[model samples]
Target: MAIKPSKGFIYLLIVAVFVFGVPSEAHAEPSYAKYGRAAMQETANRYPDANIIDYKYEGHFETSGARNEERFRLWLRGSGGEFGVRVHVYVAADTGQVRNVELEEIAR
Candidate 1:
């Protein structure tokens, strides 16, 4: 014969699950994602007429004096033409604030 759990015990279990939910591992967003957003926004700002067709994350690197850069290449199509731009989004290492953005046109 099998014994059943008491209603009070089942109630407690349901309450616990409702309050805490199921246990699961936490996932963190990659560091590049934040900087990548900046890159995308700046690219749009600079090339207002262009539509980004492709994006590639090249690398993340630290620069002099608490500065870091997220490098990416974006291909865009606009009224002017289709081209590629290498974007560098430099940010403050501690605060994640934008320090500078640099764009260079490249042959695609």
Candidate 2:
């Protein structure tokens, strides 16, 4: 008698590769709350009427294509209800740029 792999087992193996095999650096990076401060200031400058109470980098990921490009969502609040604004902010591994921003609402 010979042992055979189950269909479910093979599927799990494939998922594991996509999930843990690749490094995060290949796709995107994480962002924190402090990183959103600058965008808040800019928004404040652009839209004086709209008061930017808070903002944060939701996450970072490559969009459209790699090219080291990425879009990070910034949770924002002001005149409008709570929502997110995706912005183009890509920082290299050691670029000293905003990696990610933590959400204040969910911080606690």
Candidate 3:
């Protein structure tokens, strides 16, 4: 004799397939994405001789009204050696208009 599945077991199996088979919706990038791009572009421009090895978004911080900062850390390799750079892109909190950018070279 062959083992057979009951009607309820078949229904549950079908439900499970429909529930977990389809892929989930795609995720959107963060609001501060523009600032991150600006950081990368500006860093590349400033250090034309250096090649960016890695990029990491640090976080967001509010300084004053309508002013905020997006922090990032970029690892770069140059003729001297490898080093880390902290790039800060300042922007308006509400509008996201870029105000200024500050780049600092950190000791490795």
Q: Judging by TM-score against the true structure, name the best candidate.
A: 3
lDDT agreement of model 1 with the native: 0.88
> 76-97 in candidate 1: lDDT tens per residue?
9998789999999988988889
lDDT of 3 by residue, 1-108 (tens): 999999999999999997788665545577778898999999999999999999999999989997999999999999999999999999988888999999999866
Clash count, predicted structure 3 = 0
Off by over 4 Å in 2: 1-31, 53-56, 62-85, 98-108
Clashes of each: 0, 10, 0
**Best by the lDDT measure:** 3
The order by descending TM-score is 3, 1, 2
TM-score for predicted model 1 compared with the true structure: 0.70
**lDDT, residue 88, candidate 2:** 50
**Which has the higher lDDT value, candidate number 2 or candidate number 3?**
3
Q: After TM-score superposition, what is the CA distance of residue 103 in candidate 1 from its true location, in Å?
A: 1.2
Per-candidate TM-scores read 0.70, 0.35, 0.73
Per residue, candidate 2 scores C-alpha lDDT tens digits across 1-108 of 999999999999999998899777656644433344555654456545544444444454544332233334445555655555555544444453644322223221
